[model samples]
Each structure stands twice: as C-alpha cells, then as structure tokens.
Target chain A: MIEGHDLDYVVSGIQTLHRVSIRAEAGEIVCVLGPNGAGKSTLFRLLSGEIAPRAGKVTLLGHDVTTTPKDTLATMRAVMPQESVLSFPFTAFEVVMLGRTPHATAGETMADRAIARAAMAATDSLAYEDRTFSSLSGGERQRVTAARVLAQIWEGEEGRALLLDEPTSSLDLLHQHGLLETATTMAERGCAVVCILHDLNLAARYATRVVVLQEGRKVAEGTPREVLTRALLADVFEVDARIFVPEGTEIPVVVPRGPLSKTKPPRLATGALL
Target chain B: MTMAEAPTSRPTPRAVARPFAWATSRSFVLAAGCLVVALSVVLGCAVGAVHVPPLEVLQSMLGLETPHREMLMSIRFPRVALGLLVGSGLGLSGASLQGVFRNPIVDPGFLGISTGAVLFAVVAVVLGGHGAVSTMRTALGAPLLLSAAAFVGALVAMLSVRWLATVEGRLSLTALLLSGLAVNTVAGALTGVLLYAATDVQVVTVTFWTFGSLGGATWGTVLRVAPIFALGLVTLPRLGRSLDALVLGDAEAGHLGIPVERTKLLVIVVSALLVGAQVAVSGLVGFVGLVIPHVLRLWAGASHKTLLPASALFGAALVVLADTSARIVVKPAELPLGVITAALGAPFFLALLLKERRRLV
Candidate 1:
C-alpha cells in the first residue's frame, strides 16, 4: 500500500500541489488524469522519493517514506519516468541487469541474470535483448525500459507499488492497450499500480479507480463511471464530450465533440516524449 | 564480433557459462589488451640509451645475468615502472571519470585536478628555492613537499567546484562542468604568475611542469608513487557496477537503488587523487588519460566492468611505447614525453571523431 496525506509541494515559489490526499491499495489500478501543469509528474516524484514534500506524510508498505533510507524505499516501489537517456552503448539485457543493482551484493549473479531475462520475457522484449538500447525505436525502447522496472520489483513482497508517468504516450493504439494490460496483470498479482495517463478512454478501460486533477486540486475521485461524466469533463478538461457505455463494453467511452471555444485549441500533445 | 544467438528452448552458451565461465566478449578484448601491455613493457625496458637484447633483459629479470643488472635495475627498470604506474593511474581515472560524468569525451582533468596540481608544483619550485627543495628532498628522500602540496591543491580545486555546483543537495552537471572550467582558468593564471617570478634555474624546473617527461624517474620517486596508485587500483576496479548504473542519468540511477550522490562523490575524490599523484610525478602527461579509454571502449564494449580495467592495461602500454619513442626518436637529446603523446594521440583522436561524425550523420 502507498498513501500520502495533506501533500503540499512548492517549486520555485509556485504552489504545484495543495493539500492533496492520495492512496493506492493492493490488487487495484489507480489512474491519475490531469491537463498540462496539473502536478501529475510532481506527485509521482514525491511518491518515488526523488524529492521530499514541503508539508505532507508519505507512507509506503507501512513505513514513513521520508525517513526511510533510499535503498529500503527502492525495494518497495519502482518508477518509470517518461524517458531514460544513456550515453554509452549498453545492450537491452545489460540495461535490464542494472535493475538488480540494489539486490546485488558483490557482482551480478546467475540468479540476477535469470530474473532480468524473465522480466524481458514478460514485456515481450526478450527477442531484442542483444540489441543496443539506442538502436531501438520509441515503442520498443519503452517496453525495454518497463522491463527494467519490472526486474526491479520482480521478487518483492505484496503491496509493492509501480508508478508510471505517461507510459503510453509514445506508443501506438495496440501497444497502448498491451502495456496497460501488463499493468493490470501486475495489479491482479497484488501490486499497487498507479499510472498517469492523458487518454481518458484508456484510463476508463483499465483503471479500477480514477482521480481527476485540475490546477493541482483533486476535482473528483471515484470509479470511472462516477468521476468521468460529461460535466466533469467539461469543467476539468474544457471539452464538449459525450460519455456512454457501448453495447459490449462495461466501461464508459468518451467521444469528444470539439474544444469549448476556438480561442482555446485542444491540447493534444502532452510533451512527455523527452 | 558475432552476436550470441538468442536463447532458445534448448540450452545455450550463456547458460553454460552462467555459473563458472567469467570470460565474455569484453573479457576477451581485455585479455588481449593485457598481452599487448605485457609485451610492450618488456620491450620498453630493452631499448634505452644502451640497447639490451630482449632475451638478455628477460634473463636479467630472473636474476641469472649480472653483467647489465645494475643498468637495468638502477635506471631502465625504474623508468619503466614509473611509466606503468602513472599511465595506469591516468587511464583508470579517465575511464571512471567519464562514467561519472556520463560523457565519452571527458578526461580525468575535466574536474581541474591536473591544472591544480601543476599550479601548486610550480609554487613549490618558485617559492621554495633550490636550497629548500634539496633540503626537503634529502630529508624526506622522495620530493614529498612538492607532491603533498600538489595533492592538497587538487583536493581544494575539486571541492571548490563541487561546492559551486551544488544547490539544495543537488549537483547540477552543467554547473559542475562550468565551475571546473572556471577553476582551471584561475589555476592556470596563478601558474603563469609563479613562472614569471622564478629565477633562471628555477625557471627551467618550473618549465618542466608544462612539458612532462620520464627522464627524472628514480627508485625513490617510484616507491613514493606506488602507495597512491595501489590505493587507487584497489578502490577503482570495484566501482565498475556502480559506474554501469550511473551511465544512465542520476535520477534513473537513484531509482535503481544506487546511492547516486555518494557514488558520484566517491568517484570524483578517487579519480582526483589518482590524477594528482600522476601529475606530481610525471608533470601532466597529456592524451594518455584522454585517448586510451576511448580507444579501449571502441575495441571492447562500454560496460564499465570491462572498460575500466582494460583502459588501465591499454593506458600503461600506450605510455610505455610513447616514452620509448620520446627517448629514442632524436637519439641523445630526448623529446618531451608530452610531445610524443599529443602527437600520437591527437591523430588517433581526430580519426575517432571523424568516424563518430560519420556515424552521427
């Protein structure tokens, strides 16, 4: 389990998040949806222990995350940023092997290599293990990086959290669903999975629970059918949209009509590719 | 290099070598580098002012031949040992520093360690006169005052750059690199001022600070430098896995459970020590630290596990060969070791840049 209460973050004297309360339980997927500069990535950074909160309490696996050592916190949660840039020519397998760094005592053991290979297999990236990471395309690189994070938490205890920031932004439609399915599988296996996504339909289809944010405040929080209504869409995302459940589907599907006004063009690009 | 075939349902070579076999493709390249370095060291000891045959050199090394034992032991062997020590120190420091910075082109001197050491050494010569220097050398027997001052100067420069770059517990790479440049410029200016204030005889001693050579090698200098290099060797090779993780950005490395700040600090301190020690003995021999690692990375892969040790071996080889050429090229009057290194390394570096440019475009 991962929980944060009364979380407030200020960056460069601007309040990014104000009095936010968020939680992720085992065996569930919690998706965060927000517009540009809505503090989604900032929240992920706080949860990952990359940065400390100005005023808040963050607990991971029943321990105070702020006071816990980084190595101990690293064992409980894995983070996948938007992009990981490397200067050297390391192969995909070697990159994944680096995920075992915390567990490795002296050097890489045979068991570590096996776990890395298994994680690659889980991500469907085993075939390209020998290829250099820089030579791979965008989507392939994303899967390989996800494999690295998977290798990090592969053998952890229950309630380990996997946090992803814009994981499917660069992927195609099929790959988008495929990647989310992997997260759902992890959720089913008793891991707390939190994903920040821009696509509402993908969030509605995959998220067991959804939290909507606008201007750093939690606007609505509940199931997808409760939180993803037309009024919430119009008020939070500023879009004219129709929400309905199709014949064979159990989740809501949104069909956006257009922007509310021509002055405010639709913000389609998330700028998370870098 | 033939790519290992992907794992199949059947057993593979990687599986067979998983538990016991330590040799990979990178290890093969390292083994080859060790052979070349060993051969070069042996040949380097043979060709000096008096050309001892290679076989006779080997026989004397085993204590069988005593005719030229004094010449080999007293002069040539000490010089070769000094070259090996300084070369390996520079090479290993270069490789490890590049890993810490996550840049392929950076050398050990990127943090202002070399220039800082040179500046303090110049200060030792100019401010401390010939009488003072000789007195200290005779008392301590190894030029300890100059080297100790140089080490202190290097540590000061590195710490200043770190302090300037750090903000709110985070070290910015851009700030770190720029502060290094700033410190180097200041140290270089101070060195110039000291050179201007020196006497004529002191001027010659201070000039050697710029153009390095191995002509001044003695058993005393060799013994003094050995402990510093020994400490470096023990600490540096063990940093391979940390460096491998650090090649990814620091945030990524931290998420992977590495103590990013601690690892970065350790690498910076250790490499500065190694580079400072080399500068104290050899007077800023250039290009071996910068070029040897690049060439070795191209030959082997860029995994620090392989790249670090291989760089040390290849670095030792390159310096031995360069110093040999420096001693023999002009026949009696020796060229500066730094001149031969830059001349050889600059062309190779240009070729590497051209190759990389082609690949980039």
Candidate 2:
C-alpha cells in the first residue's frame, strides 16, 4: 500500500501541492490529470525523494519515509522524470540494469536479468535491448525509460510501486496507448501505479481512478466517470468541456470547447511550441 | 567500436569481458600508444650530448651489462623512469577530468588545477626555498616545498570548484565551465605575480620549470610521482561503472543509487593529485589528456570501463612521445616540453572542435 499524509510541494513562488491527499491499495491504476502548469511533475519529484515535501508525511507499507535518504527511498519506489538526456552511449539493457542499484550485489544475477527483460518485454522494448540508447527515437526512449522504472520497482518481493511524471510525453500514438495498456495491466496484477498524464482520453481509458489538479491543489478525484466531467474542467481548468460516454463504457470521454464561442480569445504568442 | 552484441547474450568472450575487453579496431590505438612510449624511452636515453647507443640503453633498462656506469646508471634510467611516470600521470588525470566534467572540450586544465600547481610552484621558488623546488630538484637536496605547494594549490582549486559549481554535488556544466575559467585566470595571474617578483636565479629556474623538461628527471622524482599514478589508475577503474552510469545525468545516476557528490569529489581529487604531481615535475604539459580520450572514443565505444584504461595507456604514450620529440627537436638546446605538447595538441584540438560540429551545444 502507498499512502500520502498531508503532502505539500512548492516551487519558486508557486505551491505545487497543497495538503494533497491520496491512497492506493493492492491493485489499482490511479492516474493524475491536469493542464499545463498544474504542478503534477513537482509532486512526482517530492514522492521520489528527488525533492523533499515542504510539510507532510509519505508512508509505504506502514513505514514513514518522508525524509528518507535518497538511496533508501529508492528501495521503496521508482520514478521516471520527464527529461532523459543521458550523456554517454549506454546500451538499452545496461540502462535498464541501473534499476538494480538499490538492491546491490545483484548484478548479472538470473533474477535481475529476468525482471529487467520482463520489464522491457512488457513495454515491447526488448527487441532493441542491445542497441545504444542514444540511437533510439523519441517514442522508443519513452518506452525504455518506462521499462527502467518498471525494472526498478519489481526488483524484489516488495511487489513494486511506480511514480511517473509525464512518462508518455515523448511516445508516439501507438506507443502511447501500448504503454498505458501495459501499465494498466500491471496495476491490475497488484502494483500501485501513479502516473501523471496530460491526455484526458488515456486517463479515462486506463485509469481505475482519476485525480484532477488545478494550480497546486487537488480539485477532484474519484471514478473516471465522476472526475472527467465538463463542470470540473471549467471550474478548475477554466476551459469549456464536454463529457462523452462511448456505448457501454462507464468512463467518460472528455473533449474541450474553446472560449472563442463565448468571447474573443487572447492574442497568441509567437514563441510557443503549441 | 560499437558493441557487436548485447551485453547479456554475447558470449563469455565478449559479455563477461565487456567492461575490460580491448576492441580489435582499437588495437592500433593500443599499439600506437605503446610504440610511442617505447620509442621515447629508447631515444630519450640515447640522444644526449653524451650520445649513448640504443643497445646500451636497452641493456641498462633491462638491468643487463652496461658500458659506462655513471652515464648509463645514474643519469639515464632516472630520466626515462621520470618521463614514463609523468607522461602517464598527466594523461590519466586529463581523461578522468574530462569524464567528470562531462564536457568533451574539458581537459586536465579545466578546473584550474594545473594552473594552481604552476602558481604555487612559482610562489615556492620566489619565496627563496632555493633548495626546495622539491620535485626533480630533489637530486639537489631541496625541501620538496614546490610539490607540496602545488598539491595544496590543486586541492584548493578543485575543492573551490566543487563547492561553487555543484548544487548538492550535482555539477552544473555552465557553472563548472564558468568557474573553471574564472579560477584558471585567477590562478594564472598569481603565477605571473610571483614570476614578476622573483630574483634573477629564481626567474631562470622558474622558466625552466614552466617549460617542463624530462631533463630534470631523477630517481627521487620518479619515487615521488610513482605512487600517485598507481593510486589514480587503480582507484579510477573501480568507478568505471559509476562513471558510465553518470552519463545518464545526475538525476539518473542518483536513481541508480550512486552517491553522485561523493563520486564527483573522488574524480576531482584524484585528477588534481595526479595532474598536480605531473605538472610539478613536467611543468604544465597540455593536451595529453585532451586529445587522446576523444580519439580513443571514436575507436572504442563510449563505455568508460574500457575508455578509462585505454585513454590512460593512450595518454601515457602521447606525453612520452611529445616529451621525447621536445628533447630531440632541438637536441643540443632542448625546446620546452610545453611547446611540443602544444604543437601536437593544438592541431588536434581544432580538428576535434570542428568535427564535433553537430554535438557542439
């Protein structure tokens, strides 16, 4: 079980997490969804021990480790940051083997290789295990990064817990769906998964539950049907939205509406990638 | 060379030895490095005003029968030994510094460690410890104060850089480069100040030191530098995996459970100690570390496990050959060792910068 008690994350002048609360039992895929500048990445950093929470408690399996040392915290969970600009030309397999660090003394063991290979296979990245990571495409790098996180989380009988910040950002359309499908499957098999996603369709499809954040605070969270609503989108995201249900699916499919229909939109910025 | 197979599935000959195997393509690199070091040792011994022969040089080196006792025994061996030691030391230090800094353009001089050594060496000579240039001057029964100062200076420079440019021990390249430039310029000015204030005799001695010669080579100097090289080579390989792991950036290295701060500190100190000792003895020979690693990387895949050792051997060869050429180029009146290194190094540096056109940030 992974649970947070009064977690708070702040960056620069912004509070990224404000008394955010959450819990994940034995088997569940809890996806966090938010718009740009919503502070999801900051929360992942705090949970991974990449950065310390301003005030709150984080406990896994009944042990308090909010202030645990980095290596110590690594033993309990694994996190994949948004950017993966590695400097050297490490092989894909060698890159994944880094997940074995916290375990120590497990290098080249049968168990280690099996778990690493399985993680790669799970994300369909096993075929390129021998290739240099630098030569991979953006989507391939995303899958490999996800595989590394999975390998780390499953290192021992600890049963694995994963925390990712926009892990699908660089992936292509097929890879995006493939990766989320695998992650959802793993969560069903009893891994506590917390993934930050920008795509509402993916969240609605794969998440057992959904978390909505605006600014730095948690605005809504419940079943996919309950959180993926037009009312919450406008109130929190400040954008008009519509919720659709496809046939027999209980999860709502979300689509956003523009402000142009109500009032003239603000001028566009030239430097923006969007 | 790019890996021919995956680390796991490759047979024992490749997989088990991936961390240690020397690639077939790099055999030339290995041989070129070896051949130069060998040629330098023989030629350096035979080509003085005394004009010893190649055979006699070999005999003396092998501890076999010798013709002239004093010429072959005392003078020649010490010079050859010192050349090999200082050469290899400078090379390894340069390679390790480049890896730690993670910038292809970086070399042993980046953190101002070598400049710091030079500054302290000048200070020691200027302060009138006339008998204490303490490096090769050990034959003259000096205090070794020069080397002592250089070591302290190198350590201080490395520590200052580590403290300022690293945020919680995660080195920021921008900060590191900026700090290196700042520290190098500052340390270099201190050297100039000392040189300006020195007496005529001190100035001459300092000039020769700055030129960096194996001419000052002696058994005692070899003794002082030997342990540092051994310590660095031995310790650096232990961090091969850590260094390789570090390429994934600090956050990734940390995720892999490496103590990033501690690893950076070790690399900096080891590089400083190694480079400072060589500079104290050889007088700031540049480019041995800078050019060799890149050249080797083009041949050997970017795995530090193999890269570190190969670079060390290659670096050792570069210095020994450059020092040898420096000795013979103006034999009766030797050119500065620094001059030879620059002649060899500058061209290579320009080429590397140009060829790395795409990788330039």
Deviation of model 1 at A121, angstroms = 2.7
lDDT of 1 by residue, A1-274 (tens): 9987888999899999998888999888999998898888888888888888999988888888778887787777888889877768888998998888878857778989988987776666777787789889888888789888878887755868999999988787876876787777777777898899999999999999998888988888999988999998888888989999988877999999977784476556787555
TM-score for each predicted model, relative to the true structure: 0.89, 0.85
Worst 10 residues of 2 chain B by lDDT: B1-10
Candidate 1 local lDDT, residue B266: 82
Q: What is the C-alpha lDDT of each candidate?
A: 0.80, 0.72
Regions of model 1 farther than 4 Å from truth: A262-274, B1-26, B109-112, B134-142, B156-185, B352-361
lDDT of 2 by residue, B1-361 (tens): 1111222222322124354445433455557667777777787778766778898888877777777657866887777677777766776676676667776667766667778887877776777564544234542234245566677788888777767788765667667767888898998877778877776767766676666777767677778667877888798866766776677777777766677879988988887777777777777787778877777776666667667777777676666667666766776777888888888889998896686556644
* lDDT for A245 (candidate 1): 92
* lDDT value, candidate 2, whole model: 0.72
Q: Show the colliding residue pairs in model 2.
A: A87-B247, B1-B299, B1-B300, B1-B301, B131-B142, B132-B143, B134-B144
